[model samples]
Target: MNDPQFNPETDLNFDPDGVPTEPAPAPEPTPPLPEAPHPVATGRVNTGRFEPVRQLYQRICSEVSKVYVGQEELVLSTLVALFSGGHVLIESVPGLGKTLFVRTLGKTLGTKFGRIQFTADLMPSDITGAPIFNMKTQEFTFRPGPVFTQILLADEINRSPAKTHAALLEIMQERRVTVERTTHQLEPPFLVMATQNPIESEGTYNLPEAQLDRFMFKVMVEYPTAMEEVRVLKEHSGQVAVEQRLEDEVATVTGPEQIMKAIQLCSQVLVADELFDYINNIVRQTRSWPQFHIGASPRAGIALVQGARTLAAFNGRDYAIPDDVGEIVLPALRHRVVLTAEAEVEGHQVDEALRNMIRTVEVPRM
Candidate 1:
């Protein structure tokens, strides 16, 4: 009533409650830009924090190359199995540098290396050690054999009797040895690289399926190419030169601690759901496929995935692709499955049948 023209609408700077009386602003519209893809969704996982993995991978290959000539695939496969925390089986004739390759790997990794020459007369006690009475202390002492080392090369493993071969099954799977009712644990980074002669079967015993399943990979070492042969001949002209070269040229690039670190890093590699489906399809086909009498076990699928992760790390990728699985599946399952009599009569090989399975499986769209 102070001013007749003072209308509430025009003088509405203050409300009855003394709160500001401005009209609410319009809501901002969200931008309509396209959504960004998730790291895993895009198929390329991030390696932002794992620089050491790629660095160590390159360093190891470079160091192993100095003394060990070409066989890049062999070296890579072995390294994959190593970082995967699994054992390797190398099959070839005598004197193809199988022993040298293993020895060089041991030296390169700077681990405690031991060699056991498997023979028909070899006993489990010889490999896992036996308890002996200590004359000085008048007490029983447990002495560890070659199995106590970080890397054990079981040379000519097939020459050993079944009983001796069975000794490794427990230790390989459990990473521990039980002796005289006492269990001893193997140190981390333990690996066994066993070699066998493929040409000779007269005295060799067939590795049982249980023992075969324990191996992560059964690599078939073939004859060197003409160029590679020439290089080997030039490098190993004399035994003394070879030994000196291995000692001087092949430097220790790393140790067990670094290896364990790499193994841990490998476990972090990203694998998408689609890739898992692909692995499942491939493994499932093995069971139903007519070519195989005994198909790959579930463990084989897991091994493939683990090895693929390591391979992905080696290639400096944070995510595993279908190619990585394809590259490692053969080695992972070659020893795990057996061909049917019909397939064998038709001259089908395990690797060939596995390849066919892969080709038949549908690859997920990236």
Candidate 2:
């Protein structure tokens, strides 16, 4: 019987005189290493797929920082919402650079920017535009409004009447506006960055729950740190005109195509099967918790997953992990959940509720 484990080359039987050995057999070939998939191409500028995404992200941060000064969390969270294909609601007092930040982002991406100073009398037509009869042509022509742009800064959005707010509902969700029974599609990569003053409730209409739900994150832009304030002052201490020129001066880091492609890439990020259950578990618990009058909706769960994937990609990973889900749960769910009167009386906060839920839920071992 032949020896199965025997190798003619390695297992040679040498004669008493070593010189009497037969020639050695050929050696076995070494197996090749498996190759990884190439990163997805981003756009016309093929600066190596994922590398440009990360580089552009960092470049935007650097360029925006030149004028916006500090507020890294505010900037990053906004990017997360953008890349996740969701809108953002910013709560801050006037002069916190909320409008400037949105404009800077728009300029940085080379996308069209529009700003609507939402007031008590700001009409729906003022935002979504209307059809006007062309006397010469004898036909009604559809006129596009600022909302038709890629990035919209709805300044003091809550100050507008509920009717005006309602105008945004369809477009925010469906990305299309209807006027005179005709629907028009908005340009791609449309994001609404609405601002509100949390300290003042007078003359401000509370955002409808549906409107609030449309936002993926409700970021509170606070006063800058002492150092940041100093830097901001120094950077803008130049001519007021120069200060206003920052957005215009910003070189385009990317275009609408790349921004849209990056968003698509983020959507395609891998979310393990177990993570879906984990996300659902967290969202489901919000409903049954004793302190809550309203829990996060199904849409909130989807937002959490999407936001997590964006974060994972921002960190240069194709696959999402538990930490990715955890990092965004609070911001993504904070505005979505409402506290009961009893809980509010007890000083229970939505963030606290989320923290407790995080501690209670069993994080699946990846």
The 0-to-1 C-alpha lDDT of every candidate, in the order given, reads: 0.78, 0.77
lDDT of 1 by residue, 201-318 (tens): 9988999998998898989888888998898888777666555776888767677876776687678788889988888888888888888898888888888889878877666566
State the lDDT at 288 in candidate 1.
86
Give the per-residue lDDT digits (tens) of candidate 2, residues 32-134: 2122123343212212223334455766786677667777778987889888888989888898887778878877777888899999989999999999999
- Give all TM-scores, in the order shown: 0.86, 0.84
Global CA lDDT computed for model 2: 0.77
Clash count per candidate: 0, 0
Worst 10 residues of 2 by lDDT: 41-50
Top TM-score hit: 1
Any residue pairs clashing in model 2, and if so which? none
Q: What is the C-alpha RMSD of each candidate to the true structure, in Å?
A: 17.6, 15.6
